[model samples]
Target chain A: MLAALAFVAGWPLARTIWFGFTDASLGSLADAEWVGFANYLEWFDYGDGEGEWFGLLADAAWWEAVRNTLFFALVTVSIETALGMVVALVLNARFPLRGLVRAGVLVPWAIPTIVSAKMWAWMLNDQFGIINDLGVRLGLLAAPVAWVASADTALIAVMIVDIWKTTPFMALLILAGLQMIPEDIYEAARIDGVNPLLVFWKVTLPLVAPAILVAIVFRALDALRVFDIVYVLTPNNASTTTMSVFAQQNLFQFDQFAYGSAASTALFLVIGLVTLGYLRLARLDLGN
Target chain B: MRRAVGLAKRIGFWALVALILFVSLFPFYYAILTSLETGTAIFEPNYFPEVFDLRNYAQVLGQGSFPRNVLNSILVATATVAISLFLGVTAAFALARIPFRGRKLLLLTVLSVSMFPQIAVLAGLFEMMRFLGLYNTLGSLILSYLIFTLPFTVWVLTTFMRDLPIEIEEAAIVDGAGPWDIVRRVFLPLMGPALAATGLLAFIQAWNEFLFALTFVASNETRTVPVAIALISGASSQETPWGPIMAASVIVTAPLIVLVMIFQRRIAAGLTTGGVKG
Candidate 1:
């Protein structure tokens, strides 16, 4: 099993990084020459002491993908964290049919990303979408807005779906943290006649902060590599294109294997930083 | 004034509950409504089902390759789950019960393997699959999907194995059973619930994966349901068959919803174990 994991996880990642340094194309992968970071950046000399740097790092679209991915990760993680706290707090309370609501929250989480993409694509349809219908009826919009198709709202649309899908998961993780705090803490606060809101701000938030941090980091790592939803939600919308989507399009659609490999390697490094942080956090928690 | 504030709070709480339920489920409900509409009515904006029509379902089923894709998904998911469970059980056994050097490091390594993003190894896996002549075949999918499922299964089952009382294994050993025999005879019997939960989770992961299925395979016959629906609706909006697409989406999601409901607790057993979708 260990060996299988090494082969599955370690070997491929190593080779992918190695391939990023080569001039390999999908057509003739075997005989490709080592380009030594040429795929990432190449110095092109036009003589007369003039030279230009070229490669993935120099590409505007690649930078856009990076910015978009970072933006998505930052914004979605923030919104999802706040909303997830609310959901967790609500579920923590003893209410009638709380279990039902909890289960319902998982509904979005349960649906497959591609299926949700399609479902949302239909719902966000400008002409006949129920969202447009409701929006117009509620006077929220003067006209039907193309949610996924329009460049202005495409990434927002993707972020909205992601939050809808992942907030429940975040809530559950936070709830676990909330459950870990001994009941006596809250009981003592109640006995003191402290405001419920103050109790939450002073006690609950501090206690659950670690778990919420872990959840945010995990969800951020996921959002950074956002692909299927973006790919399926708005196929060719460049404004909403993320790092994973850009890498995939280059790898398969555009057939720039080496360039795509470079993009993948860069993304791996970015995510690797977060994974290391997570590992450190996990270690600290375990040490306790 | 105090009573009024209390009443307002009550109303606010119920309203929040209603909002949660609506946000959670309205898309799927609207999908069902849309799938049941036929002809011109299918394109018309309506919150409720205006017509009860089975034509979309029939069309999706009759799309020739849709059923084949579904079968492909089933076969791939089943094969992946079966193999993952088989390997996971033995791995969990060793990791849980066996005393060995570097065990702790190995266990941590196993746990971290589950966190690998699919894109990190896409290019290399594509090359390997093509070299093995498994590209565009279901074999490619099963092979790549193990990168996700195997780690998860092994980790989940291993956690479960550690919590089981050690006396059972000791008794098996006293009965003169070998390690493999004890595993098969003693541990396997007790692993029913853990095996099922891990198997179901692995199955869902394999079923919902898209990047590998999309990148590795090209033919309609070999494409999974997700990619098939994606290709069908990938065309421009006017020609995008929303009704058939909705029907297909519902078909793929129904089984998952049912499984999730049944195994909800099993899913929450670990961190992000219920991540059947990405």
Candidate 2:
């Protein structure tokens, strides 16, 4: 089992990192020559030792992708966490048909990412989009606005799709934490005549805080590597181009395999650092 | 006055529940509604199913390798789930039940691998596929899909395995059973629910995987449903066949919805066990 994981994940990752150093193209991997730091950054010397930097690190598009990925991660994770908390709280409350409601919530989570992306893409179509039709009719918009196709609304569209699909996951995790809390804590608060709102703020939130923290890290990392939604919803739209999309596009489409590997390696470094920093700050000893 | 306030509170609670259900489920409802509408009627965004015409469904299902795509998805997902569970259960026994040097580190390593971005390995996996002559074959996807699915299955099953009462295993040992026999004959049966949940989740993950499917497989015949739906583009972006696309989306999501409905409890449990419990 470890062997499979090593081959599938570890070996490929090692090869990817190595490819980052060598100037390899897609078709002719065997013929590629080693050029350390050239893919990441290199000071190209000119006449009289005047030089300019060039590499994946120096590329404006790569940085734009980084910014877009971070922004998407930040916005979507924050919204999903907050919204998921609300949903989890609701689920935890005494409600009729709770099972049905819970299953209903899982619908979005259960749907395939690509299918949901395509589903939203169809609904966000400016010409025949339900969103545009409803927006115009309900005074949400005066015109039929192109959603995923338009530059201005494209990133927002991607975030909206992501948050919609992922909030259920966050909610489910938080709900599990909520269930883990002993019911008597709330009972005591009620006996003391504590305000329900205060019980939620001072009691419930603090107890479920760890689960929320873990869920945040999980969702945030996943969001940072967002690909399918952006790729399907707003393909080739520069405004919504994320690191994964940008890297994959270069890897195969543009045939800049080595450069794409650098971008990918950069992304891995960011995620790795974030994971370590989070593990450190949270003191989450998974070994336990 | 107090009675009126109580009434308002009750109304508000129900309203909130209704809203949650709506936001959670409205898009799928809209997708089904859209799928039912035919040609030009699709342009009109009626909230309800305006027509029950199956033409769009027929159109997508009848031609253009969409059904073949669905079959490909089923075949790949089933194999992935089967192999992952088979491998995962054994790994879990070793990781959870046995103590060994570097075991903790190896377990953590498996956990971290699940966090890997698919793009990070795409270039290399693509090359690996070509070198092994598995490129464009379904085998390439199954192998790449394992990178994500295997970790989750192992982690979740390990958690489940540790929680199993040791008395049963002790009794099995007294019956002169070896470790392999204990795992295959003893714990395997006991892990039925956990295995089902983990396998379902793994199946869904494999079914829905797009990045690897798109990167590894190159032919129309080998395309899974996700990639098929994604590649189901029109001549102009504006002229996209929404009817067929929505139809295909619904088709691809239907079995998953059914599976989730049947196993929602187990899946929810599996998801948290694999995630928050860590």
Candidate 3:
């Protein structure tokens, strides 16, 4: 029964891997052409009459998508981690309405990603957006800016929405880690006349390092494979496209199923490496 | 003097923390603000509304496919939660107590599978869904969602099951209770918190899922809340009715917020435990 259950959990994923290397259309199973590495190679330019090595190197679109993905992951995850730890540490401290505050923080997280993206998109509209209105009124800008319409602001706009939607999740996880540290340990440090900064660095940081790593790993993996926010926020725009968006465009919008599968397979490996890195770093011991 | 200094530092730390929380929640506040405003008022280059109207909700709820989407979302999410928990709890018991061979390898493989990005399997799953004639059905969406939810559920529940006392289960077994009986009478009551937490996690994940739902379900009748709200912004290419879209976003998100509020502590505990298991 356990084996059967595990099989159910894993069979679809294994099938996914198999489909990546084949030119399988969604329309039929009998038409799958076994094209080994053709899809992967096609990640580089495979245009008609193209030279081999130079053409591959000149695939700027794929590189731009890669760059945008990495930039999104790096910026959003770093900001979220710093801000989340602070929120976690604060929630760890005693206060009235602590439960309410904690719950309030999770509201964005619980809100569907697509919903929040739409909400942010509406708020950032150039003509009637509250953000633009506030920006002009507060002297932040001279005129309404098309935050999601243009390439320059589209990526940043998407990042802000992503960070707003996910920081609560990071904070909650880190807060759990913060609570796991014994109060007596901190009290002991205080008795030794340790400064606040030293106590946090020497005592809290090292002890909570595992949780922080876990949080980053999970967030990074999700961010690397992000799709819905960018898709909903900036459709029909090239500037804000991440790898997932690019792959999705091929899969759904363009019906390039084989190529999209290959792209998704590449993403799987990137995230798999990160997960393995975290498992080693955290010395994560699973099993009875 | 030292006590005074300590008190001041604590106050400052809390204030800083409160500031972060405020920033984190500011967009949601803005969402509610925009949702409550009239389109004419919102387009007037005004940051604050002079008058509030619930007309956006009335308009969106009455016409814009919100109600049908909500019903579809609830049905899909509830079914996903139920199926994931049922399978996960049973499998977790077998792993935690059965002393079976390959248990360790199986656990590791399940964890790794849980970590694998869903997109990697998108094309394959899509093909399979099409093959099985389940494409664009809520059933297909639920099954695809199980790929992520089940493994994590089993893993997390295994951790929780391990923490339960062994003697209680052993005694039940000695009394000639079968596996089903032992699970029902001995463990089910004890698993309320774990079940609730895991079920809630699975529900929220299914509720918030977008990519698969977007790719698979093309019609408005089968579309979930996330997809509904997402497509709402495109009343036209040149004109998006912000008031109705924001209103729909809020209405769709309200239930999720309630779920989080009621189960905040359990959700936090479950998340930490799942992380540890991973």
* TM-score on alpha carbons, each prediction: 0.95, 0.97, 0.91
Where is the poorest 10-residue window by lDDT in model 1 chain A?
A98-107
Docking quality class, candidate 1? medium
lDDT for residue A68 in candidate 3, whole number 0-100: 89
Write the candidate numbers in order of decreasing lDDT.
2, 1, 3
lDDT of 3 at A244: 85
Q: lDDT tens string, model 3, A116-153?
A: 78878877888777789788888999998999988899
Mark the regions of model 2 whose C-alpha exceeds 4 Å error after superposition. A48-50, A284-288, B235-238, B276-278
- Per-residue C-alpha lDDT of model 1 across residues B1-278, encoded as one tens digit per residue: 99999999999998988887888899889888888887799777887667999999999998679999999999999999988888899998899888899988887777666667789899999888888899899998987888888887888788888999999888888989999998899888888877887887788778888899999999999999889888875357567788898989999989888877777766655444433233
Task: Enumerate the chain B TM-scores of all models.
Answer: 0.92, 0.96, 0.93
Give a tens-digit lDDT track for model 1, residues A1-288.
777777767888888888899988889889878889799888999998999999998999999999999999999999999999988888888888776677677777777788889898888888878888899999999999989878899999999888888898898888878888999999999999999999989999989988887787778878888898999988888899899998998888898998898999999998988788777987898798
Off by over 4 Å in 3: A1-9, A25-29, A42-58, A277-288, B1-11, B45-49, B233-235, B276-278
Off by over 4 Å in 1: A277-288, B1-7, B234-237, B271-278
DockQ score for candidate 2: 0.68
Docking class of predicted structure 2? medium
lDDT (Cα atoms) of all candidates against the true structure? 0.85, 0.89, 0.80
lDDT of 2 by residue, B125-232 (tens): 988999999999999988898888899899999999999999999999999999999998999899999999999899989988889998899999999999999988
Per-model DockQ against the true two-chain complex: 0.64, 0.68, 0.58
Give candidate 1's error at residue B270 in angstroms.
Answer: 4.0
Could you tell me the lDDT of residue A145 within candidate 1?
Answer: 99
